[model samples]
Target: MVRRGVLGYVLVLVGGLVVSVLPASSAVASLPLVADLRSSTGGRMLGLAVVVVGLGLASSAWLRLVRAAGDLGVREDDRTALVHRATAAWTLPLLLAPPLFSRDGWSYAAQGVLTHLGLSPYVWTPSILDGQVVEAVDPMWLATATPYGPLPLVWGSAAAGLTTDPWLLVVAHRLLALVGLALLAWAVPRLSRWSRVDPARASALVLASPLVLAHGVGGVHNDLLMAGLAAVALVVAARHGWLVGALVVGLGVAVKLPAGVAGVGVVLVTLPAAARVSARATRATQVGAVSLLTVVCIGAVSHLGVGWVHALGVPGEVQTPLSVSTQLGRLAHLLTGADLVDAFRTAGSVLLVVVAVTVGLRSRSGDRRTALRATAAVALALVVLSPVVHHWYVLWCLPFLAAVELPARGWQALLHASWLGGLVAPLDSSLRGADAVIAVGVAVVAATALVQAVGHRRAEIRAEVRAGAQARTGDASPTSPISR
Candidate 1:
């Protein structure tokens, strides 16, 4: 145990050190940690190399936690605390440094600046902060209004109120992410109980994930807070009744629209056990009340009024190749010589609704497990089918996925591979677009293939064990031999 802890700590600290030494993301004009490290030809390559090595170390630490977790349903000392410590150690360095690998953090700061100035973040672009704030924001988002929900905008405004220093505003966002991590740490144990998974392993998977650390805390994305709230809501609904669940999930929705799925799941899982007409009527009424209450409350608190409704669709306007919908749109455009982004996005939204309906319909009466799994499915499907797939978006699904058991090893590895690839994708752009796509593609393929191979081996071992047990039973007792 001591050895494992030491190794994890070492790997995490090394990764943190690497992050400290590397330059800030190329997208931002200036970063506190990289002020001295100007963008030179060789310096850029060295920075990329450092990123690769640091991420590798981080991955190793995560794998070690997984292996050490073993098959125990409950661990002896509850190493999740250790994992959290490691996460903190890993996060501290990045928090002090500029946002690594993405300029979205800068946009977040710029939005906060606008909010502090008593401006509607949903209405105004970062252009209003025309001097340093505009320079801090990526040009792509400079002219575009913020797509974030009202709660985050409020929090950002509060952070910006602390100091006019753009860097300090960024730090405030990171601190908010740390608070989210705290919420996650509290929720993971309860979720493991609900899902019947090992508490330690689930905590490690959700809390200590490289994607969570790198994109979540390091990028200072508000998705972390949304997901943490969603997880807490799921657990509360499982332990308490749907009313409490609805309220908490509504709070999450106030933070981000994506979290609305939690509210939907809460309602689905509250279906009555008897399946009687009366029972169904009662359940439907309760759900409707919860839903209405959530909507009214959320609308009331939305300082930006209904303008955020328009801003909600802003992400769809940007066609990054990362999204499956955008990928299909590109393919369709290539084939038909017309832009199909809107059509593809519409299809994606339809598919998301279908997934929700399917989950709701298939949920067995009085089965919390089925409902929770459906919730997880909805969360994952939302990100997968969305028109804009940021790496941080994947964080929306991790807690839910951690709560449930993945059906197959290959599928589990595939999920990890997806997020792992997401973590590395930004590094490619940071490398001045020098073969990042191909490199990430090759890394993903190789990692998934390796996982598949290991999964097959585990399957064979289980098969042999079952076969041996059956053969031993036949040899020991009345294996009624062929009478003929």
Candidate 2:
């Protein structure tokens, strides 16, 4: 474990140094600080190489951490501590770097600029900003209003803070994201214990995930913040009262709209059985009222108004790859030679609702484990079906999914596949030509890895079952230690 920690930290530190010194997006490069490095194509290529290498190292380190976590004999608290230490070692350097791999960080700063100007982010684009902030934001988003929730926008407003420097604002926003990581670090282990998962294993799965650290913290996306808060809400729901948990979940949704979906599982868990139809309905109504009211009250306090709802459908306007809706749209066109993009999108939405309802109903078993699994199922269904899917969005489903124990190799398979897929795929564009080829290559590798891992796990389970059966049979035999 110590060796793995040291290796992971070294690789992460090197990666951070490389990314920090390298030129970033064009908008960031336009700044005087990195003007010289910006012009060097070779330098940028070298930096990219370093970043990829770093990711590989981090991925390896995670495997080692998983191995450490597999020692069930270890104290749960001690394992949690190790996971936390590993997270800090791996995350801090990436945080210090200038938004390692995505231009979205620049967009975040620009959105903050818009908020600072008292413009409703839902109605106006960053193009309204007439300075470096304009250049910092991607043109794709220039004509489109922000789809971010009000809480993140409000944070952006504070981050903007009279600084015309886009870099400063980007750093400020990243710092805010750091707070969210801290929240996750604190909440995940507790949530794991409450959910009856091995706290150490759960912590390792979440904290050491490349998707969480690389795309989440490194890109400085607000989704991590939302996820952190949502984790807290889940923990509260399990250990404390439902009303307070409802409020916390609402706060998470205020950061990003999807966080509210998790509340469905929370509410379902509180409802009585279907036999008590009227009582169940009453409980449902109360939960809905409190949850929605909490969200509205939080929005009101943020002063962003409810206009943000107008942007809720904005993400659908952009078609991202690897999403169920996007692929379905393509399939429809291929089958009928007609554009059924909108129809397919609507279908995906309907499918997601169906899946969420099914999972929520399943959660009515009233077990915290069932509720968490339900929450994960709903989140996974939503991400798979959503019109827009950033690779980082996978992180949304990870915490709860991790809480449900699977065999170590099964979890490893998922971790490797998700990490590889997330690393290769871009959120904004469909994979095509060479990019598609490369993504396919990565998928093939990940699939192969999964098969191998799954095989090993199956063997282990078989062995365990055989051993248990033998022990039972031996115990039943009267001659076996006098039936002791």
Largest TM-score belongs to which candidate? 2
lDDT of 1 by residue, 1-484 (tens): 3343334334333333333322233333355434433344344344444455455555555655554443333343556666666666666656665565566777888888888898887788887776555555666678887766667777788887787666677788888788788889888777767667666667777777778877777677788888998888877776788888877776677677788777656765666663554554565467556744665565567455545667787777667767898899889999999989788988998999898776666566566677678878899899999878877787788887777866556335644653375346345333344564335434643564466446544744664465457668774222111000
> Model 1: clashing residue pairs?
none
Question: lDDT values of the candidates?
Answer: 0.66, 0.66
Model 1 regions lying over 4 Å from their true place: 1-37, 71-77, 274-302, 422-425, 428-484
Q: For every model shown, what is its TM-score relative to the native structure? A: 0.81, 0.82
> What is the Å distance of residue 148 in model 1 from its true position?
1.7
The best candidate by lDDT is: 2
Model 1 scores a TM of 0.81
Error of 2 at 469 (Å): 19
lDDT of 1: 0.66
